[model samples]
Target: SSAITKSTKIVLNLESLGSLPADEAGPLARYASTIQAQRHDYNGKVLSIRTEDLKSLAIIYDMSPDELTTRLIEWGVLSPGADGSIYTDED
Candidate 1:
C-alpha cells in the first residue's frame, strides 16, 4: 500500500479573517485559533507563501497578478524590496 499527500503554501494577513468570504473564513479562523494557543507571538509571525502560487492563485481568485500583489502588500503579507523585487517579511 502507498500513501500520497498534496499540499501547498499560502500567505495570510491580519485582515485575512475579515476579508475572506464566509466559506473560506471559517477554516482560516480555526487555523488561527489553533496557532494562537500554541504561540503567544503567532499574531506577529509571518507565513510566506510559495512564489509559484502567486499567479495561479490570483487567477483562481479572479484577479490579475498586479491586483493580487497590491492586495497582499496592503494586507501587510507582501513587501516590495528596495531593489524593485517583491518579498515577504519571512523571506
Candidate 2:
C-alpha cells in the first residue's frame, strides 16, 4: 500500500505586481494573500483575503496578475476561468 498525503500548492509570481494594472492585479493579489504561511495551526491559512493586505503585498512583492495566472495554470495550481478569476481546489 502507498501513503497518500494531501497538501495544496499555491504559486504567486511576486515580481510583476507592479508592472500590471491595479484593477487586474489587485483582485489576484487579493486572492493570493489569503494563502498566508503562519505560526499557529498546522496550516494557518484563511479561506479568504482582504483588500488592504493585497495592496500592501503588491507594493512589496514582484507579483504580476497576468503572468501569475499563466504560470499557475501551467503549474496546475490554478484553473483558468472566465469573469476574470482563477481557482484552486484545496481540501
Candidate 3:
C-alpha cells in the first residue's frame, strides 16, 4: 500500500507578483499581509508558503483552494508546473 499525502507548501514566483499591475497586486499584497504567511525565498526567487496559509487566503476570497488556483491561473498569476502541478506564480 502507498500513502498519499497532500503537498504542504505553495510555491510562487516573486517576479510574477512584481509584474502584476499595481491595481491587481495591490489588493493581493494587502490580503497576503493579513495571512502573515511565512515566506521562504529561494535562489530562483520563488516564494514557498504553507498550504494552510494559501487556504487562509482562499477563505478571504470566499473560495476553495482549487477555485482560487483556477482564478490565479486566469489572472496569469499561476501556471501548471512540468510535473502536472497547477502551482506556480508566473505568467
Candidate 4:
C-alpha cells in the first residue's frame, strides 16, 4: 500500500505531452512509446512520465528509484535537471 502510494507519486510526476516526431527516436522516446503501447489507461490516453514518475515505475517494476533513475540517465531517457524535474534534451 505504502509502496504503491509511493509509486503512484512517481507515476503522477509524469507529464502528458505531445508525441515525439517519427524520426526523433531516442532511448527516452522508445521507452515512452513502449509505455504507451502497453495500453496502460491514463485518463483515457497515453501519458508521459517525468522525474516524479520514476518512483512509481520503480516500485511497479521492482526497481529502486535511484537505480531506475540511473538506468534512465544511462539510456538517455532522462537528462540531468538543474531543478527538481528532469529535462529531456531534444538534441
User: lDDT of all predictions, in order shown?
Assistant: 0.53, 0.42, 0.59, 0.47
What are the per-residue Cα lDDT tens digits for candidate 2 across 1-91?
A: 2111121223233444334566655655454544543422223322333334434444454654344336446644445444445444343
| Span of 10 residues, lowest total lDDT, candidate 3 | 1-10
Best by TM-score: 3
Sorted by TM-score (best first), the order is 3, 1, 4, 2
lDDT tens per residue, model 3, 8-90: 34666556766778775666656544444433323445555566666777787777777776666666666655654656644
Q: lDDT at 28 for candidate 3?
A: 61
lDDT of 2: 0.42
lDDT of 3: 0.59
* Residue clash pairs of candidate 3: none
Q: Is candidate 2 or candidate 3 better by TM-score?
A: 3
Those runs of model 3 whose alpha carbons end farther than 4 Å from true positions after fitting are 1-5, 31-44, 82-84, 89-91
**TM-score of candidate 2 versus the correct structure, residues matched by position:** 0.33
C-alpha TM-scores of all predictions: 0.46, 0.33, 0.61, 0.40
CA lDDT for candidate 4: 0.47
lDDT of 1 at 2: 10
Inter-residue clash pairs, candidate 2: 13-63, 14-62, 14-63, 15-62, 15-63, 16-62, 16-63, 16-64, 17-63, 17-64
User: For model 1, how does the per-residue alpha-carbon lDDT over 1-91 read when each residue is reduced to its tens digit?
Assistant: 1111123234556454456665644544555555566665464545444555566566655777667666656655556555445655543
**Cα RMSD, each candidate:** 9.3, 12.5, 5.3, 8.4
